[model samples]
Target: MKASSGYAGVPRWVLAIAIIGALFVVLPLVAMVVRVNWGQLIPLITSKESTDALLLSLRTSGAATLLCIIVGVPMALVLARTRFPGQRIVRSLVLLPLVLPPVVGGIALLYTFGRQGLLKAPMDFLGIQIAFSTTAVILAQTFVALPFLVLSLEGALRTVGTRYEAIGATLGAGPTTVLRRITLPLVLPALVSGAVLSFARALGEFGATLTFAGSLQGVTRTLPLEIYLQRESDPDAAVALALVLVAVAILVVGLAHQASLGNAGGRQRLL
Candidate 1:
């Protein structure tokens, strides 16, 4: 396509570098796919351990997605609409986990929610133990995944601007009405895209979940953790599990791309 578009301005070295970068990303995935045991793929991933991890991943990730949406949408709205002291700092903090190492984030969660940590007395009195539990898995997933939803939703809110909201207010609509009727519909695509990205991130989460939730089989052993364990003695099963993740990643990208296209089409229709 670049060649067909009359890309005469591009230098040979630039194209070479671009191809090399693409190869770096594509080669490893291709290797995984190529090495997959085609005949035993089904049996490998459907085994008890595989099924447990896969199911746990889906459940925790789904819970995390819901948590992100609930908390993240409001946070995004606040960031996009409000002006206050240290606003930049708040925004940075909201996105801090995105750049922070997963293991580091897990430790942070541990400090905040662990038995002997900040909320220890409150949790202990209530008989709630978060760390090293399935609940801990969901909590850790939420910690790492929240930023994806927030950043995407905040961008969406800004792109939507405040024109419609202002008009609605001028016409006697309350803030809640405007938000429910105008702002939400406008940002629906972004919401879906963000949620998909968050779910994918949670599904692939490893370091944080491992540190916070522990790899207890049928409890906290998610797909990635399971893949790591399988690699030691069951390379074929690991490959099969890895393929499952690759398929999920592909689906997530496809959904986000489709959402983008839908949003573009919606704007064209509005125009």
Candidate 2:
């Protein structure tokens, strides 16, 4: 061990900076928790509209996450494991929704799938009116949340090297067999974590859902929308709703963290 020149090899300034940064990050959560009025929490949550919005939020977000899994897992495989001309561009395009403003995303969806949109005639012929409906809520949530699943799964794929898959292929395994048996199991934890996080994000979504789905009661009014509307008429009720969202967010993120850590630990044990 090296001798310290009265500094213990770690400057007090650095420790202070770290503590300050941590406090800054944690203060808002603390504030929200402290501000919540616990006395009326249950009654506030039991309000008809609040319950409706909460259920709608869960249903739509869950549906959107299912859609993400159906579409995103394959795309993640392509982006992480394959190569072609313009491959980098294609990968970047997948992440565009994450960085884009949600309202702008809503407008983009409107232009592409709304009434009188590019495919409007065919969609109308098929009796598919996508805007301002429960279906629209799912679409808006899926549009914003798909990238999260894709990106997380891509990272997991990168971590899980292709060597195992190549060896499986040499062992008389077909592409489908290798993917179903080898690739999916190895990446499942990431996929699950991504799905959970995406569901939480979609549940808390506001701008795009409002713009595309139109806050119709019991149809499209999700928890966030209800909270926004309630703020104008009942501030206490809004705070209670906000607390619920905060609790859900915390639980989701905590589960994601635990799941990711468990996966890493399992992988290490296997190695």
Candidate 3:
């Protein structure tokens, strides 16, 4: 006799609930698509303000993703491959931004980098101004995006384990050499997924950027912020811009999903 499928064990009620959950997530996107003024979509999204916001968002998000990869790789390596005092606490703190409200993050950033902040003296001594600048927007995006990369890469590293690294060391490979040759190649797919996710998160960043950078067209006003500002004055334009943001988000999410699948496939092959 033919065997039952794995999902055959799921109850009808569970399937019904799952459908509801999917609809709950999907219906809003459907509604937004329906609300878009197709005839005016191009004109609306091509406006000077919209273009500026789009370009700024892309630039900042790209920079934030790069920053996430640079710092997050080391952080994941430390968390996954090393043991030290307060390690748990450090990991928790590193992941805090994932759960913390964006506004709260912005507030934290403000006090840490703002004019009258704790670092004010040092900042003034160096003649560096970070608050309410484009740099502040990039920093805010990085602050929130970093956790995604760190979490993804760390999990991947943990799963791949240190066996290969140990073997490399036994063969006279130095720590850096082992990491460069073995560990990173093993988790490259995860790193790509994490970086893409970070870019997506940075693109959607609004509250922290608003609080920290203070919206300035062609400067700090990213797409999400632009959508908010346009909501009152031009609902149609806002909807159009929102759709653009949604499209970019969908592309990024799709890339991340593919990368994750590759990561899983690689792990299976390794095993």
lDDT of 1 by residue, 222-241 (tens): 99999999999999999999
lDDT of 3 by residue, 7-38 (tens): 68776778889999999999999999999999
- Show how many residue pairs clash in every candidate, following the order shown: 0, 0, 0
Instruction: List the RMSD of every prediction in angstroms.
Output: 2.5, 2.0, 1.5
TM per model? 0.95, 0.94, 0.97
Instruction: Compute the lDDT of residue 241 as modeled in candidate 3.
Output: 98
> What does the lDDT come to for candidate 3?
0.95
Question: Judged by TM-score, which candidate is best?
Answer: 3
Which parts of model 3 are misplaced by more than 4 Å? 1-7
User: Which stretches of model 1 miss by more than 4 angstroms?
Assistant: 1-13
- Ordered from best to worst TM-score, the candidate numbers read 3, 1, 2
- For model 2, the stretches where C-alpha displacement exceeds 4 angstroms are 3-12
Cα displacement (Å) at residue 8, model 2: 11
**Tens-digit per-residue lDDT, 1-271, candidate 2:** 8676435577778878888999998998888778778898899999899999999999999999999999999999999999899998998888999999999888888877899678899998999999899999999999999999999999989997898899999999999999999998988889888998899889888889888889999999999999999999988899899989988988999988887987697678657
